[model samples]
Target: MIALLNNLKTYLPFSLLDNKAFKRIEESAQIAYYPENTVLIEENEIPSTFFLIIKGIVESKDGEELIDIYHNDDVFGGIELIKNQPSAYQYKVNEELICYEIPKEVFLELCQKNSEFKNYFFSSIVERMDMLKERKESAKMADMMLTRVDDSILHSACIVDHTMPIIDAITKMENESAVALLVKNESGYGIVTDADLREYILHHEEKNLTIISQIQTYPIISVTEGELLFNVLLLMTGRSIKHLPVLNAEEEVIGLLELIDLLSHFANQSHIIHVQIEKATDLQSVIDASKRIDTMIKTLHLKGVKSRYIARLVSEMHKKMYAKLFELIFPHEWHDRCTLILLGSEGRGEQILKTDQDNGLIFEEGFEPKDQVEITLKFTETLDAIGFPRCKGNVMVINPKWAKSTTKYKEDIRRWITSPGNDDLMDMAIFFDTFAVAGKISIFKDLRDFLMEQIKQHKAFLPHFARSIESFESPLGLFSRFVSSDKGHKDEIDIKKGALFALIHGVRALALEHGIHKTNTTERIKALNDIGYMSKEDAGDLLETLEVINTLRLHSQLEKLEKEKEIDNYICLSTLSKLERDTLKEALKTVEEFKKVVSYHFHLSMVG
Candidate 1:
């Protein structure tokens, strides 16, 4: 039984146990083995003892369908035991099963005596609770931001030749209410519009006699057939054009892209700003583009375009601008040789505003250069110019320490995790979440697999890493009030620090434990739920809480950008809508629940 307890300790928050505690656990545990397809535990039944699998498989079921099947070394049932509640899902053996059954009181005694073990156990429970709250919020938010370009009906316009008279084109524009005409030219297609006509009337002064072809805007802005009208709107707004010709590769006109055609697709400004970021060439251009981003966010805040959509739009723009900045510094030849990987918030497509840089580089194997060091420094400088503030801990690719070939990078990660320091381990946590944004995706995949392999080997890293999740406190303070301070900014709490970071960091830890790498908070929570890291109710709540945080941060960043302040993650709840404020309060409450769960899992002492 003592040997059995030691074996179970490997998966049972062992970090929290000492010699005596281990012995106590050993005495309390009941070792049992069963053949395949036997029901080990049933849903809603009171768990007599928390099951710690020794070998074989334990399948968690919902009705008759198998939801999860745990192999050797997986832990469950502790959640129900800790909560003193009924089992939420049925447990059965899908194969020959070996498990050590430990009673709740003995587990509780271990939790009480072992601080680290207690933290680990309670943290998991609290984290699960927080997930339930966030999931609900995220679902409501996703529904609000849904967009479709298929709402508008496409009307076939009268096709005309370039030789058509100005009066003839005017007649067509009036009859069809079409703002533009696509005419076949010797080269491709020419665009003639009311804007073109007006320009001719203003500039030419003798347009009554000039041929429409002479005044036509050549090389019309166009899109491929079947392109979403939403994308067309983005192009038009980015270029400040009113009309675009939809064309096939054969240079034939398919349809006309119009502002009116896409008016119903999205909130106009968000769509337009996305286009602006894509077209921006330099830092100043991005700054200008962000003004529109600011306005769009404000409109969403006012009109209530669910927070999830707002977060998604902000993340999309951030990625595009970063990519564009990279394009500006390193044109096609250089960019193709390496992949720019984004980790943390930006990688997950959940960034609401400017935050610390969480990025790295994955250069192609055997791309050693004569001036590699200088070139890397130059690349980093360019990103800084375009507003990706340097990572405080120097995680950027420019450091050369982080920039490595696929094989070397994997070797370094193994060294970093096995013999970790604060900085090295932090880097591992960040880099582990990385997803490739640009360049060879195959290289990205290889790097991801290598990192995952390391993580699996050193699963102990997760609980240690998860311990940091609770280091930062949630926004709610004494008496359920928000913690307020004037540090960095006056008369306001750093919402990002006090609220969102804790949730994000905690979720990220759980994600690592489960080997789920999807970045969007909602997506992460859902994935955790599917695998039983979080219950369904908890997943729903977490999604909502994330949406609220994202929505608040989005609006705040937009406001800051408007005032010419550099974008940062700070939100003043006073500036938010009543509904937003209510959601925020609820979200903060949910965050506290999340923190408690993290503390529980880590065996950290908690107040409530």
Candidate 2:
């Protein structure tokens, strides 16, 4: 019994239990063993005991269909025991099984005593699953948190008295091999960097006689010894400064922090890639710089950065690449006359990988260049070479239909609103997510204002737009199990159609109706909530659901790339952890609930 209690401490959530609660569990638990193929709990029978598997595997079956497999250290029958209801599935032993069985009454008593344990088992599955995943990610980030600024600082303080001459300070900085020097005066301390010295030398020829205090930057920016290394990096980036003084709690300067030191310690590949992109002068060099994005993304993911922030960073890099391409291909004069618009995911700032090129061109009326066709074709070819595939629907600027003047786009919007059909609605949806990546943004703004006015005037367009979400059903069954793909992949489901499209389209339709111009789904939900179109709680759930779905899709794509397979949105349930599976189910359920709300608001039933 003591050994069992000791083993229980190694498991999660239970490890959080107090000693008294653990003692209660140990005293009431019984050691049980079963032969292979033994039936532990049958469907339709109420569970009287909670089983914590110590060894072997258990298969959960709904009739003849396999629902899930439980391995060692997994808990079963908790939900059934909590609800005091019949088991939904039969728990059958797949191998010789050993378990610690706790009585239902004792488990209930433990729940009453330990709120954390109770919450883990009884809270909403989504919340519990999210907590578990966060705990796992927190464990992974623990080591990074231990890295302090003091650990990364390479040199001791290089200090100069306030009365010291500028020339002497420079000599001292060079002697110490320090990029910056701390200057102390009657008031306090300040920092003088290499850049500051260069500027001082450039402007003043009498550097030898000049006091260091006059040229040194005052009001020192410094980090404490115990501050996390990552936070220091963020501070430096935010301030656009490369050097900082490391101070003790008593305000005494102990060390100096140089950007090179932090960069070497963190080895931020993204920063290196950004520098390379900025310095690249040729198309091939830019393309080469773009290829390092995958590694950067993977590194960020491992560092436990949130998915939304990762997407934002990736989008920023992509925009930089596109802007560089434009600089190389288009003349400086032409840039002011044309608006380069990105449609769909790129415009929405949610693109994490190079998928498709959904872009167009908008020229000021009567300012269309005669060589537009040749230039756009070349631009599209360059983008394709950079790994962005051409849009299957020919949404690229290379298509003459998409390359139009602002006046023509306004007319197109009017036609789409007046004569709404499947293709027109699809085109309108795509255009609604437009963002100007380069060139004249005011031209795109004019078209956007005109679009909102037309959409508001034609009230019938809302129902037509909202009805499109009905094309795909939530891929969850009545019992909350996944509705597997019908395309012969039994274990896989289309996360894009089943969850992503539903949430995105539903929120987008609402945002358009309410005149909220935010293209990102999460931001759109917030805008909807602010306008009283959605409850705060519902909007939060929708945002979290979108995040989880996107995270799962990204992980699947990364896995595919790791295995040298083609990337797609299909996720295999067997490949995921049990916690992730539960979270996904809950996320899909939220999507379904959101769809119902959207349908009720738009009155989609009256459409067709």
Candidate 3:
């Protein structure tokens, strides 16, 4: 009884229960044993008991296919038992199974008495990942960072004496518009920003506010004028700061190195677009704000910002647009009732410009499709007005298949895993890549966790999933010379299908297998590398390859857009410089190598 109580406390909400509740569960629970290969629950079989695995592996198989594996310290049958619904698969004992089977009456009683326990079974929602994880500081110009930091690169500092009033320093910084002040204090030098001033105000009295040095950060990260520009960047990034004091050969404070200026080397008005999106109250205003994104993308790309960074910024802007649009259109009451999610490139944060809308919505369990069908339809239409084309596959929230409660969607996904059809496979791929953009994101998290759990049980799913990497032929030829399309676009390659798709989908498969929950290809690669799935050298090669491929794809789309032609993924091979073509060839080779790696890793040899 003591050992069982301790084991029960190891799981959540059970851990929340008092000694009395523990005693109740212990007294009611019955230990049950089963031989290997025992079928516990068949298809459509509603279990009357909740199971806590003490020792064993129970494989949940859809027909003959192993779909999921439940191990010790895991609970099962809660969903079917609570909903009084048929189970989707047969639960078979893979080994001699030992578990505590608690009757539904006992389980339901505890659930009724404990809101937290009830939520774990029903909602399963809690705090999740932030929409934007803290971002690492990035500079677009790799070679530019190598340039020596000279006076020309420096922004003039607002020099202030230590004796100067705090208000005077504030006025100087404001007047300069973009700068940190170099404060000459008796206790040596320091740097201060308006942010520093605001922080000081919180802790000190009004009279102490007049003292300027009190707010300045002493010996703040600084760099010499002749040091490499990247040195400043590294310092600022490491310190999580924007402003740094630049010093001369004699250690004389010369000016400030602002991160924004260091990155764009020119004023970036992208923040203007963000402010517009945020401040927009009406639908048209939000639509109008979104129009500026394409122009910003062009400007950033032209300014030599890395395509990856541009995509990250664009993804952020797009999410803001989505959240803002939903805020304007959806009823305030429904705001917390649903989560907006993006699919395809949009979902992966690789979306630069879109050929279609790649978005959906996940409603809480109680939400009815009929109640807000018109609003969901209008939301899709409004996005269309804002320049996103309708998805070719109709994956938008307006589609009943895409817009539904988390429970209904999970059922569809479970079916998708079991179906051998290509369309269902495609649907599975799309769903796996979803990223929540707006609403009570817990809705998306609950659904995502469900998918992951299902994927865990379905052992045959990934190998078959990994087989889709073969959908498109490798871009390289017999000798790895350029392989151009023979279709309407002559001498052109569909960079996405030829190169990007294979790399992304391959990485996606590996990520799923390793349970790396990240959606971005680059992030997934880094995570894979960190967890010893891929060597550092291989990971670095793939990352560089992705960067090159993304740059080429974006450049092609931009040029096509400029010509008023249909913007697409095709890259004109003849247009690339010999150096670029060579780099691309190398990148394509890396894709080929990685595909083979994924195929072998997933044992796709047996898949066919």
Candidate 4:
């Protein structure tokens, strides 16, 4: 009874439940035991009571036999009883079973008297429904996951020369299931299936068919062996074809895949990740891996690694794995055609434990790769699968706008910053902290040089970018007082959204105004002092405040992950210790100072 009550407590509306409530529920229920092989409930029978299993086991069966067994605090029958439906299936004793049977009326009275208990009951039912639905979807997905090209369909195919004799070809067909053959014709190739051979043999039709080319089918639907199973399935379904010839880039036939073979490979969570990474054998692999970065971070954190060091390791491995995946997918000839460039924190190899993909592509202009679309798509997809969410603003290489030849890319940047607009200035703001990750480092250096040259000469883009920085107001009131919301986040205030983004955006704008491209918030502040962008005292204060906010947000994220809750920038103000709340209040005050600087630089006059 204690175990059952404890488990019930987990689903209740409140996090904590008292011993008194548990004892009350326990005293009200009577424990009973049933012998093995006893029928508890039958399919199509109205359920009258809720059985909260205390010990032993009960089996649930559908049709002829048992499908599932439950033990311990497992609850059954309540859902059916409330719904007034025949039990979905039959329940029986798998072993001698011990349970607490609560009558329907008693259960209803318990819910009416206790709000927490009611919430727990309803939530458990909803959760069970959701779990069942998820199971069904998971099963469907698993079935579709093992998509492969069927070899049986391909077994009916053979590549043949046009000069083969009809009789010899017919004899060959008898030994091999190859009902069809791809034969070289004057234009290209033709396919002749088993039916064509039968017609030729039975009707004595076209014995002089000197070349099987005359009747072979033209064109073939084919894919590389490394193609994603999901994609292969999609193609097969779209084209309504069962067979796809597998070929190497050199156009040499490696094997043939049929729909049945494709469908045989089941989709497991790990399998999707494995396939995505494998297919990302080009620039596309890294791009795809970048998308799921947050999930990857959370998973790693859950495995009990320290946060700070984990970020560095995750970023480096991310780069290395992406490179490896690309190498696997790229045709051998084009392996050295381009270099990947990592910008921002990634370029500096200083990424600490957060999801950020700041990268671009640089390749020789004339390279004009044939598989550009396919290869890059694989890259982006892999990144997404591995838990790196896609960048909403498009800083990654999968965006064609960012994939540029070295020369063209440099020229584009030079033009954007020099001739600024709202969009142009924003683009330059992103490029300010760019750093090289992979590929030809020289191209990135040249691009940077062109950008700096233009920035130095133009001198106008900075203030425009700076002007837009003050859009986020500091969280303080008229007399520099900490403004607490009367009805804000249920019990907590999000320190990140309310404090961090505001500070980071302000500091970044200030850094760009001074042409200081340091990516780290702390480093950027120190840079501001060195260049006289801000006084030493102001820099020191701002840096301290920003660090505190960053630390709090990171801790909050870690906490949320531990509880299996969704993460956001919000910090619960109510849960904070007194010292932490005071620090956040001070951080907001620092942000107010930041607003003044932004306003002065942007030359915006205050209103009201």
Candidate 5:
């Protein structure tokens, strides 16, 4: 039994289980074996026993239709017993099967004592696999060597036609403070840097440097936009090339990325952006500071900074930017009359990369001034100019629908919860993530309290709210394989749809249920675990899975942007490394498990 416990400790649920809990399972277990092709359980039979396979393959059949094949370390019967349904498939030995069979009573006892173990078994058999490794690690290095090439402060290249003379290139570099110039050619762009010119000057006569094409380095070694700064650094160092042209997704030379600027950006990088944000007194200053955020994100993320941490930092920066812009646009007294609030992911503080504006204005009751419209419009437009794109849905303060008084917003919330339409229900969900970035923050708190009270009185709304988790099936089939779409994006998948949507919305619904104060998804999951809504092991897995999904999605989005392709939620899977692909598959599987738990919790199966 001790050896059995030790072996089981290597697998999940058991691996994460406490010693006392694991001992109970070992004590109640018994060894059992069957020969090859032996029928162990009949189809549609009411089973009261479970088995953990020790060796050989097992086949499950439904009316002579092969269901699936399970091998070593696979378990059976727990799902049926947990759901209290009759065995749906016949279990048979494909090879000689050696196993430990535990009675139904013990299985129920274990589930009662440990919810994590219960959750592990309660989801489908596909969720039963995968080893949980410790995943906490974040330490900033001596030099911030991590950043995307495009975000790495790329200097616009001095472009000239192929017919230009070498002197023209030199004059352009000196005039523009540029380190290199890209010469247009039929095949592609050719580049000549300051170093190339120096080498030419030392070796050749002045007449030899006549045409820029004469001194140009053809078939340039360039880095794509979203590629890591480290790769660029290594390339420059190894090739002894000081100037590397940066290419867009179309393979066109867009700019020159110099080693000096990259090194300077890394130097004292920790305080640079923050200092810039604090010093900005005007729109242009704010714009100069705001543009660095994407590079900072790419740098930190590639350097392994946690997503939640990055999101918080980003939120703080955005808040500062907003407050500054608002201050610049409106009278100081106006700040007292209204609060600038963020909705959706930004409100939750889980936003990574600059997404479209999901923000609004909550004003003091009856404080609607005639000039307030012009002021708020300026604020939203400035935000767009600062790189925060305008919301296509018109969820920004520029729209009258979002810019409203506190009393009016509360009235809207009450109506949504009381007799909500589809759009109203969505608005309710978005508002649930509302967070105040500027002005009277208490205005935001007051709204949250009102919304929570309405929910308490109308408790039935949660189930309907949670039904969206079923809106898109996770991009994984029951047999634990990737399932791409047959429609548009056939070769790829909407990763956000398949892997992230269910998890995000499900967690969001659960957070609202518990009235968890934190809106950040990672923080919400931790809050849930702390309050015993989920077990520690499950919470840990969920947090890691969320980070992994966010990271993977960011990586895909960056690639699409680099290629100048339409950047949506679609992920081109062909670009993923083997390790990334495997990790993604596992994450999607976890989403499937998450969906089932949420379905059962909200009685979503009975929602219709």
Candidate 6:
């Protein structure tokens, strides 16, 4: 019984079980053995026992087709046992087998007594697998997840009336031992820090009675109480501000957040990297700053920062870098005349690492400058030089078609709508995800409104748009085994195709149909759920599945980077743990389910 408990601990849900529960399972379970080819559970029969394979391969078949193969540590009959229905497939011992057979009633009692065990069976397979993986590292990540800005607030803010003299305010700051002082005025509250005082003293020669309001920064930047500390760091880094006032929901100031306070909470290097990018003046400086991004990503991941937040932080850094590049290359005057647009994943804010540049430019109608071609070509070349590779399909600003006037873009969009082909539809879909990173974003908004209107009017185009969701088959075998790549690496799977694209595009198609303007997949999922196009449960499952898939892809890319190899989408299954393999299977299953939902809604089968 002790040996059985040890073996059970090696598998999921059991591994999560408490000692007492494990003892209960050991007492309730009975050991059983069967010769090769012995039938364990037959199709159409109610499952009376739940078997955990101890040593053997159990083949599951649906009629004549082999659906799945289960090896040691895999549990069978849990589904039918829980559902109180007949087994969907037949299970047979492929090799001589040794197993623990728990009576159905005993299993049910265990499930009822153990919430964790019940959750494992209740959750989507991907989620359950993820929970199991997280259990191993939850101790480390628990502190990070619990950390909030309020926890890092060190001192009560020193407040001063706006009319108070600078010298008097300084005296209050010194008495309170505060690095920042909040100033109250008729307009609102503002903050003045030591940095502001230093700058004021250096720039001004007046020694007589300078009021706090005159020198203090106006319209103060702040964070809300209970906000994540990591997010506060990102905000401060992006804005290049050290001190932030913590405000409550009622807009009353609660505490002050100083850089030193956050420094004590997180020993993160990403913030330093962000500061370097902000101070960067030239292209080489920007390049030097860019090199630290990969290191920062790894550091954050090791710190247990979630994948979505990492992607967002990385995207913010990229945005700042690109803004700096634009400032360096093009004159400030050219900024307003054109909109710099990011397409695809970058636009969606899901880009975790450097990939090909899918970008474009939308100029004001008939507002072509003499140096337009030269400027656009130089921009693309500089991007390639800065490690953003050029788009292979020429979907960049260097292409005259993509770097067109707003009028010209409208015409192109109209053409796409009126004459939809595979190529045009792909282009339209890509453009739909566009986000203006630098420029008058309203330009992009006007075009986006036009695009959505066209889409709404052409209801017939929905089927064609939705058909792309079915383009890539979910790489799950009939019985939920992973269908690995046949072309390049046999043991690898194209996670982007098998899981990501289906979720992204399926959600995208639905979002477009409902006029949801959000580009991020997670946001789109939520919006769809809010508008009643998708149920809350389905939305959550889809988002969770996306997170799991993206996390795997990011980890795979990081591994490739460590090896000094080019990163690609194919994930080597052999490298994943047994838990990850099971989770991947479940994630892929979610993608298939989402695809069916989209197909049914769009009635894709009715299309010619």
Which number leads on TM-score?
2
In angstroms, give how far residue 153 of model 2 lies from its true place.
21
User: On residues 204-237, what C-alpha lDDT tens digit does candidate 6 reach at each position?
Assistant: 5665438888878898988888888888888888
Could you give candidate 4's per-residue lDDT for residues 1-608 as a string of tens digits?
56655655543231234566556667777788899988999889987787877677777888865555565656777667656789878899988988888777766666566665565545533243333333334434543445443322123356666777666665676665553566655554455666666666665544555546545556666676556678887898898766566666676555555555455333112222333444443544444544334444444433333343444555555566656655665555555666666655555444544445566677766777777778766666665655555666777778876677767777778777666666776666566666555455666666666666776777656666666555554555553334456364565565655666667667777765566656656677788889887899998788767656655666677577558666666676544533355466677877777777777766656321
The local lDDT score (0 to 100) that residue 238 gets in candidate 3 is 82
Per-model TM values vs. the true structure? 0.55, 0.69, 0.58, 0.47, 0.59, 0.66
Worst 10 residues of 1 by lDDT: 146-155
lDDT at residue 151 of model 3 (Cα atoms): 59
Highest-scoring model, lDDT: 2
Alpha-carbon lDDT, every model:
0.67, 0.81, 0.79, 0.61, 0.76, 0.80
Lowest lDDT 10-mer window, candidate 3?
127-136
Candidate 2: lDDT of 376? 90
> Residue by residue across 271-355, what tens digits does model 5's lDDT show?
4466556766778777877877776776665565666777878888777777777777777886888888889888888777776
Off by over 4 Å in 5: 1-264, 267-270
- Expressed as tens digits, the lDDT of each residue in 422-485 for candidate 1 is 7766777677667687666678887777777788998766666776666666666653445666
Residue 597 displacement in candidate 2 (angstroms): 1.5
lDDT of 1 at 160: 66
Q: Candidate 6: where is the Cα deviation over 4 Å? A: 1-68, 71-268
- Ranked candidates (TM-score, high to low): 2, 6, 5, 3, 1, 4
Q: State the lDDT of candidate 3 residue by residue for 323-419, as single tens digits.
A: 8988888888888888889998899988888678998888898876455688988998898887888988898887888888888898888988876
Q: Alpha-carbon error at 60 in model 4, in Å?
A: 62
Clashes of 1: 42
Error of 5 at 603 (Å): 1.2
Q: How far is candidate 6 from the true structure (C-alpha RMSD, Å)?
A: 10.6
